[model samples]
Target: MTEGTIPAALERAAERFAAREALVDGEVRLTYAELARRVRQAARFFEGHERVGICSPNTWHWVVAGLGALYAGATLIPVNTRFTARETIDVLERAKVSALAITGTFLGTDRLAELGSSRPGTVLRIPVEGAEVPFDGVSEWDALTGLDSDFVSPAKPDDVSDILFTSGTTGRSKGAMSSHRQALSVAEAWGECGGLTEEDRYLVINPFFHSFGYKAGILAAILRGATILPQRTFEVRETLHLVEAERITVLPGAPTIYQVLLDAPERGNHDLSSLRLAVTGAATVPVALVERMRTELGFDTVLTAYGLTEAVVATMSRPEDDANLVAHFSGRATAGFEVKLGEYGEVLLRGPNVMLGYLDDPDATAEAIDTEGWLHTGDVGVLNERGYLRIVDRIKDMYVCKGFNVYPAEIEQALGWLDGVAESAVIGVPDAVYGEAGKAYIRLRPGAEVSTADVLAHCKANLANYKLPRYIEFVAELPRNLSGKVLKRVLREENG
Candidate 1:
C-alpha cells in the first residue's frame, strides 16, 4: 500500500486481490491478476518511449495502455476522443509523444485515416470488436498484449505521470502536468470522500480522457478493491439495464444525467434498489433536483464535489451534510487542500493535487500559479462563514451589462427554478442602449410549454433589473461538449 507510482499500486492490488474483478467492458472482464499480467506485457512495447499517447474510448484497452505506459516509466497523454485530426495532431506534437495507441474508428469516422501522415513515431491500432476498419503499417494491440515480459522500471513519486489539457473554452488548451504523487493524492482523497468499498460496483460514465473519469473514476476504484464497469457513452435505457443487471452500487456523473433518468418513464420499472451512492457536480445543481434524487430515487447518499482538471477533488460535500447544503454549495476543502477566496472573489487553492505547471508554457504557468504556490482557479466563488464554497461563475464568462457585473450561472440557476425550463444558458449580446445585454437560450422539458413573456417575468421577479435577460429564445437543445459543459463560444459565434 506504500506504492509511490500508479503501476506499483496496481502491483500491490494484484497481490492482495488477485481473484477480484478489476475491470468490466461489455463482454470483456479481467481480474486483478489478469489485468496486471496484461499491463506488464504491454509495458514492454513502451520500454524505450518517454511519452505515449492513448486515443481511444472508455475500454479495458485504454486502461491497460495507460497503466502500461506508467509501468514502462513513460508519461501518458490521453487525447480526447472527440478531438478533430488537427486538434489531435496539435496534442501529439506538443506532448512530444513517441508512440500512439488508437482505435481504427469511433462514431463512424476513421480516426487513424483522419490523422493522415501525422503519425507521431509508432502507430498501434486497437481493434474494435464489431468494427471492420483496417489500417496499414500499424502494429496491432494483440502484438503488444501478447508479448511476454515482467519488466517494470522504477518510478519516483515526483515523476510526471500525465499531462491533461484544459477544455479550451476561453482560449487554446493548456496541458496541465501532474506528478505521480498529485494523481495518487487525488485518487486517495476521492476514494475516502466517497467511501468506496470492496463490494461497491462502480459504473463509470465519465470519459477516461478527463480527470473526472481517469483520476476519480478509474484510479479511485483501483485504490479501493471495487469493480469498474466502463461505459463508453451515456444512454438512458442501456444505462438502466446495466445498473439493474450489474447491481451497480456507485454511479456518478453530471446533473444532466440524473435529469434524463428522472424524465424517463421506464425508470421506475428498473430494480435500482442496489444503488446506494450517487455523486454529481461540475454545474449549477438545483436544490429540488438533489432532494428528488434522494427521496424519489431511493439513493442513500448523494454527494456533490467541486474540482478542476488542474486540481482534482479539491472540495466535496460530506455524507452527513443536509440536502440543501449539498446542492447549494460545494463542501469544505479536502484534508490536504487549502482553500481561500481572493480579493476579487476568485477561488484560490494550494494542495498536493495542484498541477506542477502548464507544459512548455512558462508564461501561462506563471499566470496561473503564483510565487506562493496558490493556484488561481479563474472562477468566482464565495466562501461562507462555515467554509462551504458557492461558485458564482467563471470570471471570463461574466459580462458587464450597463456597468453592472452579470453572472450567467446565477441567471441559469434562477431559470432552472421555472416550471417549464429544462436547461438554460445566458450570454452577453450587443445592444444599442446598454452597450451589452443578456440573451438567454433555453430548452424546455418535454411536453412542457412556456412563452418568452413567462420566462421574462420569472427572471424579473427572481433577478435584479440589470441581471434580467433582455432577449429569450427557445431551442431544442444547447450545444455541449462531452463533459456536459455548455459551449458558450459556439453560442456567441452563432448569435453575434
Candidate 2:
C-alpha cells in the first residue's frame, strides 16, 4: 500500500473481509476480493496516465474505476452524468482528460472512444458483461480486467489525486484538486463524527463521483471496513428496501430524502429501526422534520453536517448535539478546522482539508483561498459566544428589498416552521422598482391545504416587510441533486 491514499485504507479493509460483501445493488453483490480484482484490472488499463475520467452513472463500476485510478497513481476526474453533451464536452476539453472509463452512452452516441479520441485523449469503454468494446481501435475497460489479489495502493502523501468540478451554481465550474492527505483527513473526521465501525453497513445512495460520497461516505466507510450498498438511482421505495433488507446501520442522505420518506405512506411498513445513525446535510435540515423522524422512525441519532466539493465534510453536528440545533446548524467545523467570520459575516475556513486549489485556474484559486490559506466559503454565519456556528445564509442568496437586506435562510426557516410545509427554497427574482424581491418555492405536506396568501400572511406577521416574499410559488417538490441539495440555480433559471 502506498502512502496518503484511500486505496491504502481499502486494502486494510480487504484484509479484514476478503470474502465479505463490499458492494450490493438489486441483489447483485461483490465480495472484497472480486472488487479488488476489478479495480486492479481497471488500473492496468491506465498504466501510464497522469489523469483519467470516470464517466458513469451511479454504480459499482464508477467506484472500481475511481479506486483503480488512485491505485495506479493517476488522478481521477468524476464527471457529472446530468450534464448535456455540450456541457460534457466543455468539461472534457478543459480538463485535458487523457482517458475515459465510461458507462451509459452520452449524447445518444455509444462510442465514447470515438468522441474522446479526437480530443488528444484515449477513451476506454468499460466492458458490459460478455459484450465487446463499442469502438474500433479503442481499449476495453476489461482489457486488463483481472487483478492478482495482491493489489497494493500507490499514492504520494501530497499527491493531488482527485479533481472534482464545482457545482457551477455561482459561475463557470472549476475543478478542485484534493490531495491524498487532505482527503484522508476529512474522511477520518467523518468516520469519527458518524462513529463508524466495521460492524456498520452503509447504503450508498449518494453518487460515488461526488466529493461527499468519495471522501465522507465511501472512503470513510472503507476506512472502517464497513459494507457499502450502492444504488444507481434515488428511488424512495428502492432505497427503503435496501435499508430494510441490508439492515443498514448508517444512512446518510439530504434532508429532502427524509421529507420524501416521511411522506411515503408505506414508510411505516419499512423497518428503519435497524438504522442507528442518519446523517443529513447539503442543505438545511428542518427541526420539525427531524423531530418527526425521531418520534416516528426511531432513529435517535440524526447528525447534520456541512461541507462542499472543495472541502469534504468540514463541519458536522455529532449525534450528541441537541436534535433541534443539529437541524439548525450543521455542527461547527470539524476538529482542527478554523472558521473566521469575515467582513459582512461571510464564513471562511482554514484547514488541512481545504482543496489544493482549483485545477488550472490560478486566478479563481487565488480569489477563493486567501494568502492566509482560508477558503472563502461564501456562506454567511454568526458565531455564538459558545463558539457554535449558526449559518445565516449564503452571500449570493441574500437579496435587497426596498433597501433592506433579506437572507433566504431566515425566510426559509420561518416558512419551514409552518404547518404542512415539507420544504422551502427562497430566491431573488426581478422586481420592477424594489430592485429585487424574494420568491419562495414551497413543497407542501401531503393533503395539507396552505394557501399562498395564508403563507404570506404568516411570514408577514413573523418577519419584517423586507423579509416577506412578494411572490409565492408552491412546487410539488424542489429540484435537488442526488446529495439532496436544492438546485436553487435551476429553479431561478426556470422561473426567470
Candidate 1 minimal-lDDT segment of 10 residues: 127-136
lDDT of 2: 0.78
Error of 2 at 136 (Å): 1.7
Give the clashing residue pairs of candidate 2, or none: 317-331
Local accuracy of candidate 2 as per-residue lDDT tens digits, 341-421: 998899889888788899889999999999999999898888766566778888888888999888898888888789999
Candidate 2 — which residues are off by over 4 angstroms? Answer: 105-121, 127-133, 139-153, 494-496
| Superposition-based RMSD of candidate 2 using all C-alpha atoms, in angstroms | 2.5
Q: Model 2 residue 210 lDDT? A: 84
lDDT of 1: 0.87
- TM per candidate comes to 0.97, 0.93
Question: Which residue pairs collide, candidate 1?
Answer: none
Q: In terms of TM-score, how similar is model 1 to the real structure?
A: 0.97
Query: What is the per-residue lDDT of model 1 for residues 452-484, given as tens digits with 9 covering 90 to 100?
Result: 999989999999999999999999988888888
